[model samples]
Target: MINLTGKVAVVTGASRGIGKTIAKKLHQAGADVVLVARNRELLEKNAADLGAAMVVSMDVSSADEVQAGFKEIIREKGNIDILVNNAGITRDNLLLRLKEEDIQQVLDVNLKSMFFTSKSVLKPMMKQRHGRIINITSVIGLMGNSGQSNYAASKAGIIGFTKSLAREIGSRNITVNAIAPGFIETEMTAELPETVQKEMAESIALGRFGSTEDVANAVLFLASDLAGYITGEVMNVTGGMYM
Candidate 1:
């Protein structure tokens, strides 16, 4: 079993879906978790349910909010051993019909948030000389979809960002990696048309859409000491969809 006892972890988008599961799994592995999301009520409820060490309600896409939120977390916890960049959104539209605002919103929330959150945690992580930064990207980023150009671009950006940051901080013993999940069943995926959902499932070699636990488990491994030597890598939790 992977042990993260005494480690402090911060999981953005922790109120629901894969992020929520990741937070719970890290907590189960003995890390003190801090839940970060824009929903205060949901975050508080999850924190109480999971016995999380802290809860920070903020818009992660906003650099000011991310910086301030991390500052507060460090002030109270003294350090952050793990950072999960899981806050993202998809504004799906065909290139011809995609709105300027939709593209910008997707980029800001999906890609820029990672930049902000990763920057906020670097100081504390570097000071400790050890850290794990796991970014939740998507297989869509690797193999683009027809109507998800904006989302694909953002996720692809995450892969580049992860590798670049990993190279920059590997000397500090800070491992940065990205988790690319494909067709994971979550609130977001549930909204897809039945035909689309079935088509997605058929594409996966595993013969089914993945579960939130699948992605969460991958996040757990990347966050643990087991992945200490692994950096500048993308771990696919996609059931062989892209490979």
Candidate 2:
């Protein structure tokens, strides 16, 4: 078992689904978990249930709110040992029909939030000579999807961001990585049409949609002591969809 005692983690989008599970698992592994999301009620519910390390209500896309959120955490905990950039949304539209706002919103939440939150925690992380920054990317970013140009671009941008930041922080003993999860069974995946779901399943070498636990386990591994030497890598949790 990888030890995580005394570590502090900040998980964005922790109100539900994969992000929630990741937070729960990290807490189970002995890390103090800080939950971040815009849903105050749901965030508080999960935090209370897990006895969360901290809870902050803020939209990841807003720089001011993100900065203040981190300030609050810093005041209490003084450091963030792990950062999970998981808050994302899908505004699906083909380029021909996609509105400019749809593109911008998706980019801001999925890609720009990574920049906002990662930078917010960098100083604390660097001062300690340690950190784990994990970006939740997608297989669509690896293999483009129809009617999801905006989503694809955002996730791809995260891959680029992860690599560049890994290079910048590896010297500080910090590792930056990405986890690209394919076709996970969540409310989000349930929204896909039946035909599309069948097509997605058939395309995966594992012949199944993933569970929240599947992705959460990967995040735990990356955050644990076992992943200390792994950096600048995209850990595809996609069940061989892109490979």
Candidate 3:
């Protein structure tokens, strides 16, 4: 089994959904986990449930907030070994009907947040010459979707950022990669109408929506030493939905 004992890993947007499961899986693998999100109460609850995890409350979309939050993390955890940039949001609207603020919000939270969080950990990772950066993108990013232009743009940007940053830091022994999940079961998806869900599932070769565990397992693999040689690639967990 893949083991991450002694590794200090941080997962953003970990209060719920895919991010929460990712954090849980990493913690189960023996890594020291840090749960980050804007919801301090929820984060604290999750941290407590983990029995041993640090919680950092901050707006990852802001450069200043990310800098300060990372400083706190470094102070408490000493050094980071894994960074999962899983924080994101969606503002769905047709391009013509999309508000400027919605576009900006999606870009800031879904795309720019990775820039801030990834940059915050570079110094430490580069200094040690070892680290793993895993970004959670989406199938929508790979294949454009109507009414989700902002989300698609943000996710697509993550792919570009992952590739560029991997090349820039490869010599330093840091591997950066992205995971693009297709239709997955989550709180948001649970709220969708049955007809909508069925329609979405029919498109996937798997004939069903994926579980959060499916994505978490992928994240764990990328974070483990088993994938040490892999970098700058996008792992699709779409169950043949976008192939």
Candidate 4:
């Protein structure tokens, strides 16, 4: 019901999964949506499907690439009203067995990318004095998962980063928040063993894994004016998996 007409929104990792759904949802709400992802072909296809809003192809883990990519977006779009830090990767393994590269790669893509992308948008958001920053964290970050130490650490780091940034920029009317999704059915989860998926579904109060649309709806709400008064908060789209 919230109208975002004339607003500009950016979603990273928008080529697939929750990111892609969020982009479409925002576009449906009348925001000019820009899709950011490393896959140019997918990004182009999504952009075309979304009416050619815009597409920025770059690895968000690199600070320089994020900086340069945002610069280009701002140059063309003039301002950014909403930013969804949804680009993330999961490198899962037990602590003792996890490789050093696994830890670093997970942190870089999941946590550091948020740092880079959020910082990149601050200037434009502050200048405009109105913005929404929605970070896609995870339920694993809140509690913990047995085999995903690195991913859990990165997502937890995002919660801290979201809170700190919200406090720092709240005065400017820019709200920063994080959304922690529980067991969402995506390509990644589809690869999990059937038994594991059933176990995950049984753990959720909703009795099923969430769909990408569920998470996208939450993002749409946070990105809308309805959530203007909400900041420095973590909204769990977890179907009561954790309270």
Candidate 5:
């Protein structure tokens, strides 16, 4: 069994859906969880529900906010043992039809936020000689998707970032990795038409959409000591959807 007692875990974009579930799992594993999101109200509710130690309402894509937010977290929590970069936004459109603003927003939120958050936690993790950085990427990153060029590019960038950072900090005992999930049954996916959902599920080898618990369980494993030796890899929670 994996245990994370006494660890300080920071989960960004943790107000709802996959992010919230990840935070809940980490909290259940005995980590002193800190939830981050732009939605303060929702964040506060989750913090209360999970008894999280901290909640930072900030736009993670903004470098200044992220730096200040992490500084506050480190100051209050003492140190960060785990950082989950699960905060992402989708602006889906064909290349020709995509707006300039939409492209920029997706890149900033989905891709750039990881750079900010990851950089913020490195010092404390390095000093302690241990850390786990998990980036939530997607299968569209590996298998390109129609009408989602911007989103795909952002997720793919995260994969590269994960590998490079893992290699950079492995000597310091800080492990960086990415999880790519496909067709998970979240609030967003549930809104899709029944035909669309069926079609998507049929493509997966598992023949069903995964639950939030499925992705959260992966985060739990990666964050635990059980995965101490694992780093710089992309673990797919896609049920063989892209293979």
Candidate 6:
């Protein structure tokens, strides 16, 4: 069995969906997790259910909140062994009709938040000289999509950021990687119309949508000791959607 005993991980967007499952799987792997999100009630519920080692309600877009929250974690736990930047938003619109605010919001949460959170945690991780940072992106970021211009751009940005950071911190034993999920079965996918979902399924070589667990397992692999030598690679957990 893969042993993750004694690891300390912080998963942003832990209030629900893939974040919730990632939190659970990491806990089961023996890591003490810190759950962060904007929803206090949902965070609390997840914290209780997952036995999260700690909980921090912070807006990923706000630098001050991310700084303070990471401070609290460092003050209390001394360091974070794994950091997952999973909080993101999508404001789908045609390029011509897209609003400036929509573009900024998507970039802030999907891209800029990783910059801030990764910065805040790096000091402590460098001190310990060991860390794992995973950014959740999308296959659309690689292949592009019609209406998700903002999302695609932000996710693609994460891939570039991950690669760059990996080079900067590889000497310190820090591994940075991005996971681009294909069409996964989540509340987000469930929200799509049946016709859209069917069309998407047809495109996947796997002939179906991936589950939250599919993505979570890939994340666990990257965060665990098994991936210590791996860094800066983008793993596609997309049920063969892009391959």
Clashes of 3: 0
Q: Please, what are the lDDT tens digits per residue for candidate 6 over residues 62-97?
A: 999999999998898878999999998889889999
lDDT of 3 at 241: 95
Q: Candidate 4: TM-score?
A: 0.98
Q: Each prediction's TM-score against the native? A: 0.99, 0.98, 0.98, 0.98, 0.97, 0.98
- Deviation of model 1 at 162, angstroms: 0.4
Tens-digit lDDT string for candidate 4 (1-243): 978999999999999999999999999999999999999899999988988779999999999999999999999999999999999988777899999999999999999999899989999999989999999999999998999999999999999999999999999999999999999988877877798788888888878789999999999999998999999899999898988
Question: Which candidate model has the greater TM-score, 4 or 5?
Answer: 4
Span of ten consecutive residues with least summed lDDT in model 4:
187-196
Clashes of 5: 0
Give the alpha carbon lDDT tens digit for every residue of 25-98 in model 1: 99999999999999999999998998645999999889999999999999999999999999889888899999
Residues 58-139 of candidate 3 have per-residue lDDT tens digits of: 9999999999999999999889999999988887879999999999999999999999999999999998899999999999
Sliding window of 10 residues with minimal summed lDDT for model 6: 46-55
The TM-score that candidate 3 achieves is 0.98
Q: Pick the candidate with the highest lDDT.
A: 3
Q: Candidate 4's C-alpha lDDT?
A: 0.93
Report, for every candidate in turn, its global Cα lDDT versus the true structure. Answer: 0.93, 0.93, 0.94, 0.93, 0.93, 0.93
Steric clash pairs (candidate 6) = none
List where candidate 6 sits over 4 angstroms from the true fold.
none
- Give the clash total for candidate 4: 0
What candidate 5 gets wrong by more than 4 Å, as runs, is 191-193
Colliding pairs, model 1: none
lDDT of 5 at 64: 98
Model 2 score (lDDT): 0.93
After the best TM-score superposition of candidate 3, give how far the Cα of residue 137 lies from its true spot, in angstroms.
Answer: 0.6
